[model samples]
Target chain A: MTGSPRPARLMDGTALARRLTDETTAAATALHRRTGTTPCLATVLVGEDPASVTYVRMKRNRCAQAGIRSRHLALPAATSTARLVDAIGELSADPDVHGILLQHPVGPHLDERAAFEAIAPAKDVDGVTTHSFAAMGFGLPGFVSCTPGGIMRLLDEYRVELSGKHAVVVGRSAILGKPAGLLLLGRDATVTYCHSRTRDLPSLLREADVLVAAVGKPDFIRGEHLKPGAVVIDAGYNPGNTGDVHFASARERAGLITPVPGGVGPMTIAVLLAQTVRAATRQLGLD
Target chain B: MTGSPRPARLMDGTALARRLTDETTAAATALHRRTGTTPCLATVLVGEDPASVTYVRMKRNRCAQAGIRSRHLALPAATSTARLVDAIGELSADPDVHGILLQHPVGPHLDERAAFEAIAPAKDVDGVTTHSFAAMGFGLPGFVSCTPGGIMRLLDEYRVELSGKHAVVVGRSAILGKPAGLLLLGRDATVTYCHSRTRDLPSLLREADVLVAAVGKPDFIRGEHLKPGAVVIDAGYNPGNTGDVHFASARERAGLITPVPGGVGPMTIAVLLAQTVRAATRQLGLD
Candidate 1:
């Protein structure tokens, strides 16, 4: 109430997501009619991490709504790296499975990279593999990480002029922060990556035309750190269902902003379902 | 006489390269004594382009100097993509060959990415494959693109603190400019990539704390565009042996600069040789 008179335009992820899913549903139905093949996604989740379980359940629900098939593999917490690789390898070899999604933070004991490599590049719809990452980094055609891909789709929906703009990404995780920066770089944005090791985060944040807060800390990016009229993308999903940005304060100064529950969250599953359809089409030689 | 009274100190590529090669030579010797297998590098050139021939020859010469064996395969310019891929596939399967280097810009017709993919990931010493690129992008354990690898080495050797520093890269070639920016981002630099479509290049150049001029156009980056006391890296090797930077004027303002002939040129081959030794040791179980 104490800030700018004109509040920022909210980037409505829910409405945009509904439109995206309508298109995806039509595509899936058409593909099923022509090829007599339902787009199938194989999801592998290690351990019953409550958060991961809920995430996977949400994805499964989204897939069902989109007319895509979901096959879930629930592995125990004590599974070895070799066993996880074998499980993923089996899915990668299955012609019926068009896409593979492996839940992350799968126990500290497993070698994540090795397990990711086991999934065929073609079946990497979740975009967690290094092959997918390399393709994304090089701006080549490949699956992209779901959350980052969602962020890009949202930006595109808003008709954001990314070129020549300074995009400050406040994280460096391989999946979210890194790929997001690379994707922005591919689109001609001057991308700056700041991590825990980065000095003077607020000073750098103030220079951004587009600020992406991927650091998974609630209310980490304050309104004062942002440049006035900056486009704010909150990718962080921390405890208490809050995002990385302090929404109330940030909304006053931002030109555009995404709400926590209704923003980046919905678009992620939308991308996953869409990519799965693409994977099925390509694999079935129908595209 | 027309420049600043104190020119920027040259980051001596020749001397640093010598130290690197000396270390590689010792490692090669130790590996040979342990496994009785000398490191072997396979150089493939697909055309009679004078530049390609010279580059392959230079790489082979350096391999010999380090006591590493060299194998050369010269193919006709008219060779089909399939034939080129087959040739590379054979080398990738050859147990005696520790590393592979393919001379780029084979022709306008052939698919470069396909040929690069033919090289086994483990033996991609030149780091041209998508696998290598992904590894470099993800900050994983794998070989980097030679020139970019060398640039990182030079930066590390000079103890250039990249964290939170603005690094402006003036190109976006798949192998050179793109990888260079990713490497700087990996080291926590705020990276900006400028290309032909980039608007207001001069304005962006002024903000750079570390500027990499990989644009092939000589004198493209004028002295007035550079920031005072900036670290300037000239990676261009254009016609007339001139760099992308206008050395005469830019050196006056820069605190550290790499000259055209003796700068980034020598470090490329040095990294290639070093990676070949690593490949040999890893493949031979001598690590």
Candidate 2:
């Protein structure tokens, strides 16, 4: 049996991210010239999660390409919470480190929130700090979570009007789902957050003008769940690089759909690099 | 023509808040006996906004009744942001000031976020600071905004089951609306936030097992907006002492409804006093 054709125009993160990185490189170079120090991002990885390792490496590589410095701290899988906190504390106090990124799923035993809180809000360039999240939610001036920031940038790029739209964000994770809903709310889109426990997810989906899938479940949201011509952002990256939404079916009904592998993933690193430069400039008073 | 008979069950805040205050008073007395210094809250108000003045007075009076100490700071209406920041910074740095409450709507010209950020997270017992907001959103240990905190307490008092329910919050303001939504989300509720710009808000409201009205509009949510057997919390207090939800109509539709003046307002002061004592105990190392 032949499958249905793709109906939505794909929101390409690769091209947009490349453009952003180019701009970030120029900013980084300018800051370095003025402050005599390159913008630096310290990445902390606690355990040996292969996926996390790949993500960190990708971030560092992107940093290098953007003329920013990268510092890696790899702790053992059995690292104690105190030791991890101490290491993060040191980075927080270090003036040389402009930004800090701690890859998630640190370890089964570690106090992840404590470690994240240890990072100074100013150096929380990855926007993982609680202060940043609150700031985003309150519509205050602060850094944003990378994926959510990327999603906002994409919306701006597409000129999708958010002011009066009904945005339904699937998932409520701190880094992705919760922050996404808050950001949309800040932009004047009335937002609804659906998670694993939500009843009748399909019914909620049908009422959304913009639907953001960040639940990490492959092909979880189907075509029948979507409202016609709704803007779809599939931020889920599962095994084999599939998205949370059934792309083929959702695309048929969506006005815009972002692909799994090349959509939100690329923009994460791009935002990190951009934020690192911003941090450096702010700290060095170069702006 | 006779008006429709009152159909809502009034969720009396005045009576519930009095009980809560009594409990807080007992807790405060116990703490005071254990520790010499009484639980103290520093109330900072910039300019004399009548509403803010009334609220501050109410908070202080409640503190006195609860055996909590109150320190008042009344700044001029034309206070500069930097000066205001310095004043807050001092309060935050003071060990004796266990909690700080900076009343909002501090003159239109002054930057409220900057001033709010000056309060140390440890002393931000009112949960207006960015740090507190993030902690609340992340489900971390932190004090919550008084009104939202009170709402949660009321729910617990009434034994409302929150897990796996759909909660629709009508408003997105910084302190009340947004924080209320986050608190519900943390409790495993699928939460949706509807505001003035929201399209088909009635549809969203009908899906809610729990409805929170905080839009500061009188009777914005009517009986038609409620789902049968829904738990309704009206946080709005307009000039005529009207709540956001039309309590009369809502009572017939909702399983529960908070009254206009007597419902959520009293709890706000109750939580503030409770948090002040808790903060004092923590600061005194007597907990």
Candidate 3:
């Protein structure tokens, strides 16, 4: 198994996400045609961190392409927690807004959870709120955190059988790794969560049938940790557009693997737009 | 390994919980003496299911023994979700109530999550709401679900090293298996959740270093599934007071085990009382 020179099947998340976005665009157009209500997504950012700004701009562009209107509310870097919550509350109550997205890393001073709690669960398409987390945990119908949500969609698109498979998630951030593990558990996969504190990462990672590398360190998961023929979803995008997994070595060992830039990234924005349209349809009682 | 006849060490939950209750009593008494305010637990039971009635009664008794006050609200089984939510809202606002425990299974017709959401997160000692779940997941400072909280305390008391250990939880109920897995994950343990839908239960169970048997079925976990020297925490109490694990067989091969009647049951009530006093101290601005 170690000397085999077979290349892994690349899981084409970009292509699948393109199809999904097309479906979302048709649904958004149809909803507007029938109800005369355009689905709207409100994007809130506390500071103009360049990366966060780029990410928010990309999400807005995706919404526009999907026929969903975007509202941008850029606040000052020194915005108080209460004021941020108030802004989110206003957008939550706005009848025109179908979904809410609060860009992450809100200056490190703002209370992200408090601001997220202010968004009504119905409009939490970014799925940062506790309500959405619980709904995801309990396998209830609610929006999901986009990266984790998109990874699951990619797995489904490739016909991965999750049941009874040992899925080792290599990070435990509230939105990404934690929720991803819960979603896999909902699909009957036996899920294990590892993080910086976990002892002997290689020992556990070697047992995973499905490995999700979401740790934000470049090439953190080497080829030796991967089980042969594992389905690897690399959700990490560090500086220089590098991924957490060592793709050159892993692509040979893995049965199916997602590339760094063209993999989980494209699927994430696609899920956000798709969920926004669903939120609008559900809120408008058109579902 | 299979032929070894070593008897498992019994985790004495009854004694550990007694010590914990004593500590809670001291705190409750001290808080009352300093602030002239008694810690109060508001227990709302929507229906008179005999088991729920007995469970609530046991919890109230434990609270009284720990110098905490218990306020019971018995509602008709047919109570509307709105009315139940209103009831919980009143208790949440009541200054005298430091902790709230809405008895589970508040009738299938009622929106249980809605009613639980009505209880303020500060007062949710039972830890049923999504806020508490997220807190548990994120390892934020918040009250935990009592039974899972108790199980963690037991593991700590026995000097269990959770980091990197495979902790397999055998149920997925919102409060028990799910939160238990989250708590283990927070401790850096590799957690796997298996339910009725899991295709290969014994295979996964065989790898667990810490096995939490929460499946409601009696003797669901046999001796063959347990790893040698594994710490077994059986949270299940089926009819006839039998636990999910076949204790007679499991005790021979396991390193530590909890009995059916005396184990998880005692620690749960102890945690509720402890949290109520903590809530009272915090609410009274005496923390």
Instruction: Please name the candidate that would achieve the greatest DockQ relative to the true structure.
Output: 2
Clashing pairs in 2: B7-B252, B8-B251, B13-B263
DockQ of 2: 0.80
TM-score of chain B of each: 0.97, 0.95, 0.98
Q: How does residue A93 of candidate 1 score in lDDT?
A: 95
Top-scoring candidate (TM-score)? 2
Name the regions of candidate 2 deviating beyond 4 angstroms: A1-6, B1-6
lDDT of 2 at A278: 91
Residue B73 lDDT in candidate 1: 94
- Best candidate per lDDT, number? 3
**Candidate 3 clashing pairs?**
none
Order of the predicted models by DockQ, top scorer first? 2, 3, 1
Q: lDDT for each of the candidates?
A: 0.89, 0.88, 0.91
Of 2 and 3, the candidate ahead on TM-score is 2
DockQ of 1: 0.55
Per-candidate clashes, comma-separated: 0, 3, 0
